[model samples]
Target: MTIPHFISIGHITHDLVGNGITPGGPALYSTCAARNLGISVGMITSFSRPLLQPGLLQGIDIRCQESQKTTTFANLYNEHGERRQIIESVADRITSTLIPPEWRAVSIVNICPVANEYLPEIVRLFDKALIGICPQGWMRRWDSKGQVFRKKWENFKEVLPYADIVFFSEEDVSDPKKAVETYLPYTKMVIVTQGKLGASIYSHNGVHRSPAFPTIEVDPTGAGDVFATAFLIRYFETHDVPESARFANCVASFVVEKEGIYGIPGLDDVKRRLNVAR
Candidate 1:
């Protein structure tokens, strides 16, 4: 079969995505959003058969795997957004050989990771498409008790220049003053998602910002990945950053207004909100 239009090469995870554990990751959230938008999406993820959520990889067209057991976590959090993450298990490392042959034709790739699952060399294998990354998963570090903490990043520079777009959370770019200095020169766009506060974009051409659609905040776990996937997919379609940001923001708003990964909105729902915003 031809490769799916969008291929998210990242983790297939069991997420304790703040407040509760759910099956999630770029493969789960991004591809679901992309496919709902009429974009064909595939995935290459690691999972242990027993631990992998049943039906986790269904609907997705192309999927590759190394291990059957995927990462599992206990994500505890506060109303204000502080989170305590405990990694009950971690997935296997994904390499080029682990990818399906058809991945060569996917429209876009998101190096989505719950841990550092995507290898830089594996990323180089795909032809130039919109290679976006939402690395919050890879950006995690936990103490002895598995209470997660922010830590300095490594290997980002090696793979960032290869990225057409990169994603960050409000916490990711907390130091926006340094963002441009730190990231703008490295990739095509840097998206900093601030939940209901909205997302800010810095690109080689200019800086732009889009506020989130107002919604009741529920689970914020994969909200950023949802936004990143939607925004990048919309941008791929329209090439209009602001419009894409709004569209993505709408989907993200819906994600947070609900419970978990199962709540990703369909294209009709996304457009309805976008129309409301318009």
Candidate 2:
């Protein structure tokens, strides 16, 4: 079997959108973006069987652990563009054992945990891969009523050290600067997505800002995940932070123009947008 060039580990979620439940999650979004960018993708996730049907992922390889219920989230967006979330249910956690031995050496690995379903120990399993982390789920804690709130990652020291890059939003924590500072010492790069304001990249040199391409955002649900996916892929190829950020911002611009995964662009689409932006 050909090894996937990109692998994402997390829970494929059932997002309550309007009157329907849409299949979503960071792992799903990232893998879709990776596939759209012409990379072979793989996902190790836990979800109920019917939640994900045939052909949903198309060419990507998927390894699923059966769960009683797919993790579920109800997202409520306020007038200020802030998202208030309630986790209705959680699926089974993803363990390192679920990852095939051959896949452990894939070129790129993203540890994308939503609802804290990934164990910190899983980060060590990707010894030969460039490990990127989307830490939103680790920074969240929900109330008794299931209302999700921000909380410091209790195991940042253990996980951050193993992560080559870490991605999160300015809204992921109350203090984005502090979060960047905390992760910078451990990881090679830290990126904070500031929604329409664009994103900031923090590395050894200093902080650099990248502007978001102006677009009418139909829904901002998976834009950040798309951005992270684009950045990691570009960085893997070019190894240039500023160039990667510009490319990622352009890729993510398309994600907001439509709903769900429909907006994730292929390379030709991204090139056209880049040329237009230029």
Candidate 3:
């Protein structure tokens, strides 16, 4: 079997809003984004049997550890773009032992935890790959009622050093600026994504800005995952942080124009936007 070039480890979520339910999580978005970029993608995830749709992840290789319940989240959004999330149910935690030994050696690995499903020790497994992190999950804490709130990532030092790049949205932390500063010493690159205002990239050369591509707003559910996936794919190819961020911004622009997974852009769609931007 051909090993995948890109792998995303997290939970495949069941997102509930009102009467509607859709599959979500960083694993779904990032894997789809990577596959659309012509990268061979795989996912290591957990979900209940009832929530598992056989062909939902058609193109990507998936290894699922069965769980009693799929991670379920209900997101309540206000007119001002503020969101309140409630965790209805959570899936099983994923650890290094669950990963296939052969698949551990890959070109890129995205550690995307949606509900703290992924263990920090898993980061030490990929010594040769360019490991990227979408740490929104780690920065969150839930009450006994499952209402979600932002929390400082206490284990940042342990996991950040193993990552080549780390991605997070402005709202993921209490202070985005300080979060970036805290993680910079451990990781090679830090990306703080601000919805319409664009993103900021911090590296050894200091901070640089990447402008967002213009588009009509729809759903912003998976935009950050899309951006992070596209950024890692482009960064692996070009090794230019600014260029990668710009390319990622272009790809993510299309995601916000539609709802759910329908917004993920294909290579042709990304190129078309890039051409127009140029």
Candidate 4:
């Protein structure tokens, strides 16, 4: 079978996590996950080579928007593995031209965000490709008194239509009474991840639920992003929504079993656990 090329959108950051500081930026993890799953992956993200290794550093092709410095953040975590705070990051936004002209050959586009990089307009460019989105990075975030507080934007309502697949957590599913109706029109499928509770998929066709694979979770930082990335690349092999959710749940479980993004499971690990789960 021929490998299909994929372009992951966003930024690679020099993450400064404490007791937790591990390198993670969805652009980095998602692309790594896709490549590990045997998919051809390219990256469309701004990186300061001084701070970020070349995309090839991890099997991803580079179309890096050469900025002076890559975004860097210090994620502080208590013993519980919940991330809080943004010690620092360079402010940079991605425009359409950031995508390399040759990258049009790609079949999948994962719009993983960092800071404010994956804006709606940039997402629209992938209208023809399968787009897997992790909107947490896009959520309205501000550093207040040295800590990060995240919330939905009043105007965030408008960016919904551009994504083919949307990933969010239970906290993001806020006010389900209103969210279900408000978010439905713009999305083809919406995944509400509930940490250990598992994940729920909502679409025009209705809903599907998948329970989480049991694991002694070590880190929660990039679990959702890893879940979305694995689900998109592997599940697309079947396009079965429930299977996709289940595959993602497995990836999430494996993600939490270790510390940081480096914990993202390999294909064999994912396949082994998936088999054991079955």
Q: Give the TM-score of candidate 3.
A: 0.97
Q: What is the lDDT of candidate 3?
A: 0.89
Q: Predicted candidate 4: what Cα RMSD to the true structure?
A: 3.0
- Give the alpha carbon lDDT tens digit for every residue of 88-178 in model 4: 6563677888676556546788877767765567765655677777776766476654355677644445566766787777665456536
Q: List the residue pairs that clash in candidate 3.
A: none
Q: Taking the tens digit of each residue's C-alpha lDDT, what string does model 3 give over 42-135?
A: 9999898534356667789988888999999998889987889999899998877777888878999999999998778889998989999998
Task: Report the candidate with higher TM-score, 3 versus 4.
Answer: 3
RMSD of each: 2.2, 1.2, 1.3, 3.0
**Poorest 10 consecutive residues by lDDT, candidate 4:** 49-58
Better of 1 and 2 by lDDT: 2
How much does candidate 4 score in TM-score?
0.87
* Model 1 Cα lDDT, one tens digit per residue, 95-176: 7876677676567888777777766666677666788877676667767776667654566787788788888886753475
Tens digits of per-residue lDDT, candidate 2, 90-110, equal 999887778899998799998
lDDT of 3 at 117: 87
How many Å off is the CA of 234 in candidate 2? 0.5
TM-scores vs. true structure, each candidate: 0.91, 0.97, 0.97, 0.87
Looking at model 2, report the run of 10 residues with the lowest lDDT sum.
Answer: 47-56
